[model samples]
Every structure is written in C-alpha cells, then in structure tokens.
Target: MNKRFYIIFTVILVIYFILKYLSGFYIDFEWFRQNNGLSVFWVLFMTKFNVQAMFGTIFIVLFLLNFLMIRILGGKGRFFAENFLDRINIPAIGSSRKLLLLIVTAVVIFTGFVMGGGASAFWKEYLMFKNSVPFTGFPADPVFGRDPGFYVFSLPFYKFLYGWFMSTLVIITIFTVLLHVLNGAIQKTVRGVDLSPFSRAHISIMLAMMVILYGLSYQLAAYELLFSQIGKFYGAGYTAVNANLLAYRAAEVISFIAGALLIFNVFKRSFKLPVIVMLTLIPVYFILGVIYPALQQRFIVVPNELGKETPYIQNNINFTRLAYGIDRVEEIPFANKRELTYADILKNRETLESVRLWDWRPLKQTYKQLQELKQYYYFNDVDVDRYVINGKKIAVNLSARELTIENLGVNSQTWQNQHLIYTHGYGLVMSRVDRITSEGLPVLIIKDIPPV
Candidate 1:
C-alpha cells in the first residue's frame, strides 16, 4: 500500500511538473518571465485544463512516436546480448546465479545510461522530480545508442539483456526493488566464495578495461551503430557527442567504486594502499549513471516529426486515391451538376497545383515568392518537376509568404500583433487560416502542384 501510494503520487507529480514547466506556470514570477513571459501563465491556464490535460497530450504523442519507431526499425527492442554465452537460454525455472549477476549488471548499465551523469545530471532529475516539464526528450534511439549514465551504472560489462522493460525510471525502479529482493534470496541460498575478488592490481586492470572498452564502443559501437546508421547513411545523422562513449566511461567508473565497497565488506585479507579511491569513483559513477543519464536523455534536440528538422509529413502513396487526376469528372445531365472535373480533384496533385496554391500558378512563381519572403515551407506533391528539399520531392502545396497577422480576428482573445511562425506547415497552413493562431500551430502545411 505504501509503495503503491508512492507510485501514484510520483506519477501525479510528474504530470503536474510537465504542465508547470512546459505549460509555463510558476510559483516564482521571475522564472516564468525569463522563460517566456508573465502573460504565458493566464493564457496557458485558460487554454488547458490543469496539468493532467498536458500530460494526456504528451502520453499520446510519445505512444505514437514509439509505435512509429518500432514500425520503421523492423525489430522489437534488444532482448539479449549477442555473445555465444547468451544463446544458451534456459526458461525462467533453470536460471542460475551467474545469469542473475549478468542480468543485474545489464540492468544497472541500462539504468545509468538512461539517467545521465555527474552532479548536475542528478540535480536536474531531482528538479524534474520536484517540478515536471521534462527538460529533455526521450532517450531510446531507434538506432543502437546508450548514454553516459547508462555506462556508469552498468559497470564491468556491456551486455544487452534487460530489453526495453527497464528503459524508463518507473520500470527501472520496479526492477531495482525486485533485484534487492532477489539479491537477498541468492545470498541466503548460495553459500560459496565471492567469485569477483578485487585487489589493488585487479582494480587497476578494471580501470584500464573501462578506458579501452569506452574508447572502442564510442569509436565503433555507438558511432557505427547509432550515429552512422541513421545520420550518414539515411541522411538523418547529427554531429554531436558520441552517446556510447559517455555511457561506457560512466559505467566503468561506477563499477570501480562498487567493487571497492565489496572489498571492504569481505574479511580483509590484505590492506596496503589507497582503498578509498574505489568509494569516490563508485558513488560518483552511481550518481553519474543513475542521475545524469536520465537527466541528459531528457535533454532533447527536438524530434524531426515536430517539424523542426523537416517541415513536412510524407506517407506512402495510396493507389486507390491516385485515380482522382486520371479519371475525369463525370457530368450529370438531369440534376444539372458538373461532371467529375479534374480542376475539382481532391488528391495530392490538384490539391497542391490548383486549390491550395496561394497564387494558383506554376511552381516558378511560388518558389520565387518564398525565396524573396525568407519564409520556409513544404509541399505534399512528391514529384515536383525539378525542385527538391533534403532530396525528397515536395508532397504538398506550401508557401512561406509573409502575412501581417493580428489576434483581433484570430484564436487568441487579445487584440495584439504577432508574426505567426508555423511549427507544422504544409497545405494545412495555407487553407486553415483561422486555425493558424498568431503564434501559429504550424499548418502541417502541405502544397500540391500540377503534374510535371
């Protein structure tokens, strides 16, 4: 009951925080103004019904994102490590002590990576716990990627066994609690020597391994798997710090500290030099992995789908819908209704070229106008004769024309002037003039053009 209450309370608090931060409400008046403006509070509060509404929206968005990523990636989350030892899968009944240790290691690393690293990381997470608009984005890369805190937390191993169940804090907390119970059970049932004995020399060696492995994983695994696979090859890569490297170093440092504690717990055989080094490094690592990565992953560069990277949404062509242009309008004689005219077509081609075009002319005028206006746009027509942005043909009729918009006749109830910059553009931006607030919700704006 106590744990359940804690869980429920935590969830509510998280939702509240996201609303407070992202929605821009505040107890501190100065912070709110610095972030946006004092007017943001009354405006957002009136717009959204408490923080729960904001959370509901975010949950839906994240779910859609996860679903889309799974479809495109062609695989479920990683289930186990790739080494030969992992192939020997015994069902839940026959799991051994070694397997348990391995699993623990994997869970710790996964948690660390997701959390982030260093004192600041933990502090951010703490603040996130207290306040909630997550200062970060989702951490899991569709491509193979891990964070620094994950590395620090999952010390002494690079095994990928826990899968996606342990990816989030809620899940990780459950796993941690379960592990505590399981560890107690193992200690009682199995009476033997501690297999992992640490010495001054052993500690030195592990440190070396951490450095080597971190370097290799950064240079090879993370760069090759995560960054290169998506960024360079698919033209979706961003130049940034390597995630794998950060994870690896953080994990190694954590393990070193944990190992030191283990040395103290055992009946001391020999004590020569600086044993305290382990304590400093381990806790620092734990702080780094558990607190930092979680905090860091939340540090998002914005999702491409949000129309930051590309302002258009493209989908596979539907063959049945393609009949609009090819089949001419059928005229009705008795009712005196016009036949299925090509000009009245509702598909991508006519939608872009005829109805949606602000100027209703060829691509030349539209392109030239946008260039002069210095406004960015997107098109829904995939086969625009000789124009391209980011190598994909424009799929909608869109323009970046300047419009001196005012709030007097817009959605906002205030009479104010503002430049309506869109976040989701396309034809939607052009047609739904009313829906485009002076602050612009980004018109999913697509444009269509005549067949090239």
Candidate 2:
C-alpha cells in the first residue's frame, strides 16, 4: 500500500510539472508572440521570470534575515521556542521550534512568490517609465507641464513601486513586532507593553520608509486628480486644482518631514517620538487630504459651478481631443438652402442615392432570419460602411457570419465537432443599404453560404 501510494504521488508530481512547463509555453506563444517570432516571446517570458524571482527573493530574504536577526540574535528565554502544538495534546515541536519555523518560512516564501507573480504584470509600466520619451510637436497639458504620455506611460509604475515598498515594509514591521513580543524584546509590563530600545530602533526605521511612501502616496494622488470621478466631469475641477492640489503638495512636504523625524527617533531609540509622529498622520490626512478638498468643493465650487469648472471643462475637452488625435480637425461651413433646381438634383444625385434609410437593429434580425443559412452561423451585427465597387462609391450593410456552436443539440455539440470539423464560420452577407426590394427587404449585393 505504501509503495503504491508513493508511485501514485510521484506520477502526479511528474504530470503537474509537465503541465506547468507546457502551459507556460502555450501562454507565451498565444498571448505574446510579438512580431510573430520566438525572440520577443522569450524576452517577455524571461523579463517576467527575472522580475518575479528578484522581488520574490527580496521579500523572502528580507523576511528570513529579519526573523533570524530578531528571533535568533535578539531573542531571550524559552518564549521564542514556544509552539501551539502542545496545547491540544499534540506532540510539541522541539524547543527550537524547527517544525514551526519550517511551516512559517514556507508560508512566507509562498506568499512572497505569489505576490511577485502578481507584481510581474506591471513590467510594461516599468519598461515604459524607464524608456519614457517626450512627445514631439504636441503641446503640454496646461496645468502639469507634462505631455499627455506622462500620465499614460509613467505614473502607473511609480504608484506600483510606492505600493510594493509600503506593503513590504508594513508586513515586515508587523512580523518583527510579533516576533519581538514572542521573544522578550517586548514584554507585557504592569502599565502596558514595554518595547526595548533595540526593537524600537528597528521598527522606527521600518516605519520611516512607510512614512516616506505614505507621503509620496499623496504626491501620486495629486497627479491622479485628473482621473478623479468625484466631480461632474473627469479631470481637476475648481476645488481640486485650487485646494486639493495645493493640499497634496503640503501633505507631501509634511510627510517627508514626518519621515525624517521618525528616522531621527530611530537614532534617539525613543518610542515616544515615532508614536507622536504617526499619531499626527491621522488628522493630517483627514484635514488636508479629505476635509480641505471637500470644503472647497462644497463652499466655493458649488456656488458657481459653471464659472469654476469652465477652464477645467476646456482642459478635459482639449486633452480628450488630443488623446484621440482629433485636435487638428478642420470644420467647414455649410449653407442651409431649402429650394433646389433640376441642375442641383442632377449634380448631387449620386450622393443622394447613397443615403441610408435602414437601421441596423432590424436589419441584423432580417439577415439572421433570411441569409443565415445554418443554425450555427450567427450574424453578430450589421456594419454600415462605404466601399467603391466597380467605380461607384456605394454605402453597404455588411454582417460577418460567425459560429455559435452552443446552438447545436447536446449530442451534436461534441468536442471533436466543435474543435476539428466545424471550427469557424466563413464569409459575410452584404447588401446595398439604399436599395430595398418591393417587399422592403435589402437588395443583396453579396450573398450565399460560401460568400459570393
């Protein structure tokens, strides 16, 4: 029985690893395949792998090293050796907690590696920020003095880096404090928990990084005001530009000062200073980050919304047009003449003949009913477009025929039938939009299952 179990487990592990390897290659070829070649795919795959490995190593190494430093070096007494196993009459992990250590280390490694994989998705952002080029011949945004591409190509990676470091530090800080408690570095005194100077210094330095990132968060949020949905329109409005932007700058400065103070406390090795600094951040965030902006929006911007938001509205419009590459569009004036002569009729007859009268909603249903030759062939939509056919520019309604195998009966909808035999639907149904039959049906320009 043991031998059979081992054989089954071994086979499962082999198959699992094989599937993992094959899936990586499949996804690499399918999702990537940039330039339809192997090099780009390999580059992307390795980039992701390298990033994941590097960050994963950082997370695990930092965790393990810190754990060793505090638990092994700084720890005292049998507290560090304590495990939960003995409480329930289970065999206790040895005084060294070797089993507990192994379990904790495994959990931390798994979490870090999984987090690294998720973070790897931001590689494009990193690459873009690294290789960010200035836009040519394009005007900068009126407020930021940055090209439109800065928001698109740069900001995301900065935000991600900030978040990653902040999260890592916070996690490490919590783990360190917990470990400190488990050891005797932080002992429960008569008054409260008494943190040793050594633990205080370590935690303060960790918090200094967090405070700095916290400050930087406001700065990032400043740029993100352009994408804010709190207002009537997207982008910075009166309160945001007038109050919120200024407030973010102030918060950033305050955060930097606060972070520096925390570092100063690390050297002082006094828990009091770091506590005071962190306690202040709550009110600072609420007042400057939240309340100030809300007050400005409610009191000032609300009274004269049109007057306040006009400039911002214009900015949104200009940026939107710029984003879509329609900023240089030319407008022509047209004369609204009511009467027409016979010469006018003859001159514009070709254009008049191409005016569409059929709406696509009913036309799609009509195509599905009449031209859809098979039940599996689905006409998704009727696309109205122009094409020059035989030297005449004509308007036509076209519907691409696609497969819907789910419409097949249960017995007929087999995997082999779906994947191999009837894989895709071919051809499109097309007709001149203006030319309708006597019975009000479309005049077929191109028809049939094989596509005429």
Candidate 3:
C-alpha cells in the first residue's frame, strides 16, 4: 500500500509540472493571436502541432502493429519464459506480462513523441518538397541531369523518409525476433540453432522487407554522389560519375532481386537460398561497390586526370557560377598577343580617369586623427566611390563618422551622455582620393567639427 501510494503521488506531481510547463505555451499563443494575426498564428500552430502529431502517430501505429503481430504469431499461452522471465521475480505470470507490457508501451510512446517532435521542426522542408518548383532555364547537373531545385527542395525529405522507415524496420525486426525466440519458436539445439516452421516463415517475410529497404537505400545513394567531396571539387567528379554511379545502380538491382528471393524462400522446406544470397551479396557488394570503383579511379582517371577531368571541371565551373547567381556572366579567354597602348587607354578613359589612388587600410586611421572632433567620433572605414557632379564623373573617398560611445571616460558614460548628449553621429567625412594636404593627411572636402 505504501509503494502504491508513492507511485500515485509521483504520477500526480509529474502531471502538475507538465501542466505548468504547457501553460507557458498558452500565454505565448494568446500574445501571438493578438499581435500576429489569427491566420498567422494558426498557420504556425498547425504546422508544428499537426506535423508532430501526424508523424508521431505513425511511429505509435507501427509499434502497435508489430506488437500485435508478435502476440498473434507467437501465441500467448505457449510462452517459455520460466523462472520469472529474465530473473524478474513477479509473483504471478499474467501480472509479470502486464507489467512488462506497460513498461514497453510507455517507452514506445515517449520515444515516438520525441522523435516526431524533432522531425516536425523541419516542417518547412516537408512543405517545400511537397510543392517544389523546378528550377527553369538553368543547366542541370552533368552526372544525374537534375536541377538545382531537386537537391535544395527534395533530397532532405527523401532522406528523412529513409531514416524514419529504416529505424522503425530495425526496431520492429529486433522486437519480433526476440519475442519469437522467447516463445520457444527459435532455440539452440546440440546440432545448431533451431527454428519452428512458423517462426522461419514469419521471419523470412521480415528479411524480404529489409532487403527491399536496402534496395531503396542504394538507389538514393546515387543522388547523394552529387554532394560527394571525392575529388578536387565537390559534386560528381571523375570517380563518382564513372565508378560510384555504376556501383550503386548495380547494387540496387541486386538488392531488389535478393529481396524477392528471400520472400520465395519461405515456401520452401529449408532456408538455403537466403543464406547463400546474403553471403554472395557481401563479396559482390565489395567488388561492384568497392573494388571496381577503386580500380577505376586509380588506374583509369589518375593517369590522365587533366584530360579526363576537363569536362567535369567545366561542369563544376558552370554549376559553381550557377550556385552564386552569376551564371549569366560571359566568359572570354585572354589573348597574350596584344600589347596595351594609349589608344586602348583613350577608349576606356572614363574608367581610367576615375581610378582611386588612396589605399583605405591606412586612410581610416588618418581620418580618425584628422576628422574625429570629439574622442567619441570614429571613422571605421574609408570607401572609394564615384559621384556624377555637374556633367563630370568624380571619384572620392567617403567615411561615415560613427559615434563610438564606449570611447568616452567610464564615469562619463552615463545614461544622459549616451542617449541625449551623443544621440547621433555628427555626419559623414569626405575628401578627394588623389589630394593630400601639406602635412601628408588627406585633403578634406567635407571636414568635420572645428576647421583648421
């Protein structure tokens, strides 16, 4: 009774704290509704809560389905968990199973909620993928021939799905196998490991599912080659395009066929085919997926890297330029033959005449000394710029005289000094780039404070 009372009290306290924490979101929601329109708040509300609930429900449903399947196939009464089931000294067998079920169920719910909550933070990623706008009027990737939009908008969603399914499959398989083993459907014999006919057939189906998932993973890896940093530059270079691409395709095909064969093995008396196929797959994977790619990269591409990688290099240049939104810039190779002449100078006289002579690196310090009237005024930069003044283009040096309040004496940095006394920066300081005073300071056109 005392143990039961403590448990009840702990449950009540946990519920109280959870409610208190959730109450904070209620205040946030009310504020959002008032300040940010109801529609805006609702959109954010639905995106987070709805997405989280949806994916979380999927995890729970999967667990429940696998749990039910195990119960049904393994049969309840025939469980061989003797002597308290893993040393759990419960008084009654039924009570022991119920307690174990409760713990497992709680763990499943907690894990599902956490995983789904994290997944839903990327709601924007899911939304973008659902309504992806293809990038138009751009050169596609040379290897896979996909638009930039595919990688930006779609790859993340596919990867998330892969992870979601793969993790769930792994968990389900382990749980099912363990439960079946506990039910005495699978055991160790003097000869070797033994399996009941029903267990063998049921487990065979799961093996088929895993093989199919592997096929999907292999196919997805093909797209990921574009992001590979296997060469001089990122994206599909020589080895990736020529080697990894072929390997992944072949692996995926083999994976699919192997999955089908595993399913067929269930009908046969003995499971010889699956073991053979699994063993064969490893060496085949190493050859087609590893050794072949390695050989192709070393023997084929390395010997004539420049010639082979030239086309890929050009592809990289185009894609890199596209990434920076400067794809439209025209490229023209420089010719070494022509010598620069005065006529060439005369042709571009406007550009030549407006060139800045002053370097900004030392000019900023000079401005701080010359133009900072009060110690607080600071010239952080000297910028070279052009001005069209009365039918003439003139180049000039400009600097914003920013008020650095921290430079004031510590005691004088009071509220009034910062806000009221030095409320704003004085003004801009300007000068001609080519001109210098007798003291070797810049000749000032827009001088600050008291004139010298």
Candidate 4:
C-alpha cells in the first residue's frame, strides 16, 4: 500500500507539473488568447505566483509527507491483521447525537461569522450605504433599491454559509478518516492504551457523506458563480438573458433541495433518499443548466439579434447609467468659438501653469527622496489639482496615491495592518507648481496633513 501510494503520488505530481508548463504555452497561443480573452487560464497563471498558492501547495505536500511518515513507521512486518481488521463501534464524543449536532452547528456558525467579518461590519456598511444615497426609486436601481446595500450584505453571507457548510463537512470527514488511520498506527507502535477501530458502517457512512457533500458543494458553487454573472448578462438579448436566468435559478433551487435532502439523510443515517435524489437530479441539471441555455443562445438569441436585443440594450443603458451615476451629469452642446484671446489665457493662468513639464517618473522619485516620511507609505502617482490657497486659486502638483501598509504585497499584509493600523490612507503631499524654495524643492502647500 505504501509503495502504491508513493508511485501514485509521484505520478500525480509529475502530471501536475507537465500540465502547469503546458498551460503556459496554451495561454500564449494566439488562438487561445483570442478565444478565451484572459479567462480562468489567466487567473491560474497569476495565482501560481501568489502567496496563497504557495501556502496551499505547502499544506498538501505536508499532508502527503505525514502519510508517508506514518506508513514508514508502521512497517509491514509489524502488521497485526486481527487487531487492524476487526471493526470496532466508536461512540460519539458527546453523550448524545443531538449534543454532537449542537456543537457542530455552533462551530460552523462561528466559523462563518469570523470569516465573513462578523455581523457588525455587515450592518455598518449596509446602513452607511443606505443613508449615503440621495434618492431611492426604480431609476436608482431596478431590483433591490437605490443602493446595493442589501445585495452586498447578502453576498458575503451567502459565501460564508457555503464556505461554512463545505469546510465543516470536509473537516469532520478528514478527522474521522485520520482518527481511524492514526489509531491503527498507534496500536501497532504502542501496546498500552487499547483503542477501538472504526466500525465498517461508520466508515462507509462518513465516506459516502463526504462524497455527497463534495458533489453538492461543487454544484452549488457553480450555481453561485452563474448567478453572480447576472449583471454581465444585460446586453445578451432577451432569449440569452432568459436562458441564463432559468439555468442559474433552476440550478440554485435544485442544489438547495439536494443539499437539504443530504442533511436529512445524515440525520436519518441512511443514504437511500439522497442517493436517489442525486441520481435523478444531476441529469436534469445538466439538461436545463447547460444544454438548454446553449441551445437557446445558438437558436433564438443569435438569430433574432436586432429584434430581440432592443429591450436588453435599453436595460443595459438604464442600469449602467444609474449604477455609475452617469444619468446625473448634465450634457450641453459645445460650439467651439475657435478663437483664443489674451484675457482667456490670463483667466486660465493657474491651469496653464499646472501643465506639468516634469516627467512623473523623476518627480515621483524626487518626492520619495524628499517627502515620504514612512517606508510603508510611498507615492504611487503624481497628480495635479487646482486648490484655493491664500486667496489665490493655483494649480498644485501632488502625490496623494500613497501605498499604505495595507497596499503592500500580500505576504506583508496582516490582519492588524489591514483592519486596525491602516483603516484610512496617509495624507497627501501637495506643492505649488511654479514656486520653488532656495534648496530647489517645490514649495509645500499641503504636506502630510490628513483630511479634517
């Protein structure tokens, strides 16, 4: 078993590396680039170089190493068939199943709350957005309200719930398996404490539950992903819109029902109903969630483009304008006089003086050398804005886009820096464009002073 495991692991690693390299080549291909337009391939390529992927890779490797170490320690010659093979009924940790369920439920909810930034942040942001909006009606947003506070709040909760369910299921299943494996190995090594082996029924049920939960999680994730793309579906015409909506909504409903059934089966300690549901529902899901949508797009949407696309186009226009606050901007026709007077040039002297002659690259470097007080807070860009200073409107060059501690690379970002120390940005460095001090530095109008 050890040898087989080693061989399989090595083969999988080799295949993974080969595919990883091949993916690089595939992404660089012109046809692939044109067809995909920076899709999952791009995301994978970028993620490979990130800290999260590094940590994830390290974790998997560690788990594999642990398995190898355990196998090596428990030599084949020391194996006792009677002790290892005999099925033992291990009772629940708690007094009753209900107690176990309650503990699990609490843990899952706590995990969700922590991972989702707690209820305080959610409600605070929701209320802040609701109060900030000037007006509320259909023009502001068609579905939810003027602001997307409800949608935004609900999105994180949805993610949290899904993550909690999947993670809890995975942890429990892995713990059960690991407990059995470790118990066997311990029994072989130490002779003092007698430990019960996992019963066949318990093992089978745990494995089945894990598999069912995994499948349900994956299907639900697909539903979530599809549903989230509703905003991007606006311009795709009525048929395409209808098809995608139907597909995602149907997937979500079915996935929810299937998930509920699985939970029911878990409590009942029988996989019959859940198995039947999975077998029946998956094919129907494939048809409605995949095939029907494709057929609708290919036949109905693509053919009647001019006729069917008008309403969708209007929706896209209206929603986009509302979302972006573009409808509020007044548009006036401009008739260029085609004449510039001396008075006009004098009137716009501040703007003309602000026309930057110095290259931003050198200016940024100089600003960093002279102005940047902290190492973490560095200037990213140099901007020019007109400010009223000392009863005179003057164009001032500034470096306001500071890279705060939170803006540092992912490896450097900590919870403390992200949430506490770096809640807001450092103040800007503003200097008059025309004025220069004796030391050849631009005269500082506004230095490291944050907004009042």
* Candidate topping lDDT: 2
Per-candidate TM-scores read 0.21, 0.66, 0.64, 0.37
lDDT of 4 by residue, 280-338 (tens): 77687788767897788678767776676677667678768876889889989999978
Q: How many clashes show up per model? A: 63, 0, 0, 0
Deviation in angstroms for 113 in model 4?
14
1-452 in candidate 1: lDDT tens per residue? Answer: 34466468768976886786664434645676778876865544443343334333443343334323323431222222232233454554244445655555544543343332222223322333334332133243333444423433341122221112123324433443343233331122255422122222232333333333333333334333332332222322332233334655556555545545444444442323224544455566566545554444334423332432231111111212232442345766687666776665654452443223232354435344433232343332322122354574443434443332321345543333233443233332233221233543323344333111
Where is model 3 more than 4 Å wrong at Cα? 1-42, 76-94, 188-192, 269-287, 323-452
Evaluation by lDDT, superior candidate among 3 and 4? 3
Per-residue alpha-carbon lDDT of candidate 2 for residues 1-452, written as tens digits (9 for 90 to 100): 34466468768976996799689879769766665778878777777887788788888888888788776656432332343333323134334455557556766877687768877887787778878887877888777888878987889988988888787888888988887765557766587867777688778878888888888898789889878766799888888888989999999999899989988886798878988998998899889988998998898888999998998999889878987889878988888877888999899988877888789999999898888888788998889889999998899999998888888888898889988988888898899988889998999888896777
Can you tell me which runs of candidate 2 are displaced by over 4 Å? Answer: 1-37, 68-108, 267-276, 330-339, 346-452
TM-score of 2: 0.66
Worst 10 residues of 2 by lDDT: 82-91
Question: In terms of TM-score, which candidate is stronger, 2 or 3?
Answer: 2
